[model samples]
Target: MDSRVFRGGRGFAYLEEQDRFLGGTQAPEMSFGFIGCGMMGQEHMRNAQLVGRASLGGVYDPAPKSVDCALEIAARAKGTTKPRVYASLEEACADPSTDALIVATPNFTHLDVMRVATRYNKAIFLEKPIATTVSDALEVCRLAANHTQPVRVGLQYRYKAVYAEAMEEVFGRQSVGRVCSVNMLEHRFPFLDKVGQWNKFNAYTGGTLIEKCCHYFDLMNLFAGGAPEQVFASGSQAVNFRNFAYDNQQADGLDQAQVVVNYDNGVIGGFSLSMFVPGAREELVVCGDAGRLHTVEQAQLGSENQNHLEVWAGESGRSRSSAPTYPSYIAKAGHHGATFYEHLAFVEDLVSGKATGPSLADAFWSVVVGAAAQTSIDKRTAIDIADVLPVTDDIQDLMLCGAGL
Candidate 1:
């Protein structure tokens, strides 16, 4: 760990600035109150230690085991301060020593938690999907937009160096020369057991697309240059057939998803997820007229996702010529690496004033697209993004343009 990694201070300048902005003083080493100290929350605590700036001021979880797991992680931490346990989400958010709140609670309870955290003007690091529905997501964003504190979503893929580099290739260097189309193939395992088994139902998690594939949808939006028209999807429960039975019923969860996005700029993006496959290769391909970039990746996370960008010139096809290998830096055998970088950016924003990162609109639309797709699947028709998001005179509106409302 470098000595001068994240510390940039002038005697509580960040706190004063934060106070001036949000009407509450925030510490330089931002203190976080954990609203849900379950599996993902524990991951956040471990990664918070990796960032080395935040203090775990307090933790609150209904489950005793979850709280214990959080404390166990904190006990092993190096620079991070030990956190106190609390009985409720409000208790944790109300702690004066805390500057921000980390809401890793269940999907349905997200806005319920945010409703409290927003009142305190505490910065927040909320996990993805924002909420189980678009209206709920919009309602929270509407509230947070009025609040003074900064809010960052848990979209860790954007923070990965390899992901950034790949984006750079398509957009930065124009190596791909105006990405015209994008496609992602994600074959993964069925739902693992949650502490409460809430994720097994679509009502709680907003369907498998919103719960899981929001990450990929986010990246697709980026590759599509934020221009979205309409979305259509079809899914089935064929693979996880055993889990859909009475006692083990995963009634609301879909085992397969095939989604296509039609961009206003004529860029088409497609996403497919299959949980039935024994072994599946996860890959993303971004293509343009000049050339293309492709990454053959492993779907099961953890471990540095060691993958290469297969660069091809002229066009993307079986007949196209392959030349010049763009190998990504191989990652060490580790799982928490992505979380650490994302948390660093979030904490760094807390300490050194907010800079551009994942926006509320980004979080909003990612879920909007997925939820709309699920609707499309159910209705058997293409649904417009605006039908879910309801466009207004806003940047978010500008982002989701193309197919007429």
Candidate 2:
């Protein structure tokens, strides 16, 4: 194999029969201890290899199948040792070989996991929907605030090419002018089977809004530029999982929802979600006084996603539409390539000893909005942000602008 063309830097590589760079410059910089080895946890392992900065130091999960699968992936890397199969979460956190921790446990377990992970004081890459409830998320933030190590939450949707470009157009270039409204839509199949069927119940998954739609709500908060003031939502366990039961427990996860968030900045954000659709599609629309920006990503049952972004300059400027994409290799890593960039950022921040991307505050507000929406559905009324978060003097800085920090 040609070393020049396929070097081990941003990804795995092939080595020449007799080469000097074989084990010299291609070593992974940091090793990550995985607290969960399920679907998203395995994805992080793949992306860490793709970024070529982090190696899987070890993994801890109750399910042997998950740990085996994660180890299978880790074994494919170029210059990393065989990762340890940790006996427990505490063992993973206490291992001296791992430089950081990736907490990808289920939504409900985040708080408990954070409690132990924080005690280790290792840098953490926490998965999205920090917790199942607003109060739990607030506590997670509080734990992070006291920890000395930097914490980067996994709000990876912000890194997708189409959405990233939209952010640039709306925030960087002001291409969309003064944003007045934002709309987001996601149509997809039902949730896949998990190890324990924990996701089939609202008690565990934190309802559909907090479990799945938190990503969209987070984007809405970012685009709308403030904390949501009020949320009115309607949803039900319309179709998916309605007839399903595991271990004699009935499934009650919501399969459809319509949410409208009124931001303190006077921007209205709307979201439409359907988990019973055939394939997958997500679209975002931002309208400003000057123009409008729209981006969409769609995929067939077994095909790759197609992403496109468009900006209309109204009457006074130019209009353009283009496909925003990362390298095919990177995109294949996970989450349409967003997770790869998220790992890259995580590694960079570790090297610089600086925190970037979504902070704990960002994750807290994202959950607050989703929790508020779920409560709105539960009560059949509009829910206020203050009611959801219960802002106190300690957290006052987080809600100061009612928006992305």
Q: Which segments of candidate 1 are over 4 A away from where they belong?
A: 1-28, 78-81, 241-250, 299-305, 314-336, 390-405
- 210-312 in candidate 1: lDDT tens per residue? 9988888988988888556799999877766444544565566888989999988999999989886655456789988878888765544443344455667
Q: All predictions: root-mean-square deviation over Cα?
A: 7.8, 2.9
The global Cα lDDT (0 to 1) of model 1 is 0.74
Q: Mind giving the per-residue lDDT tens digits that candidate 2 earns over 99-151?
A: 89999999989999999998986898899889998878878887887887888
Q: How many residue pairs clash in all the candidates, one count each?
A: 2, 4
Error of 2 at 136 (Å): 0.5
Off by over 4 Å in 2: 1-5, 8-25, 400-405
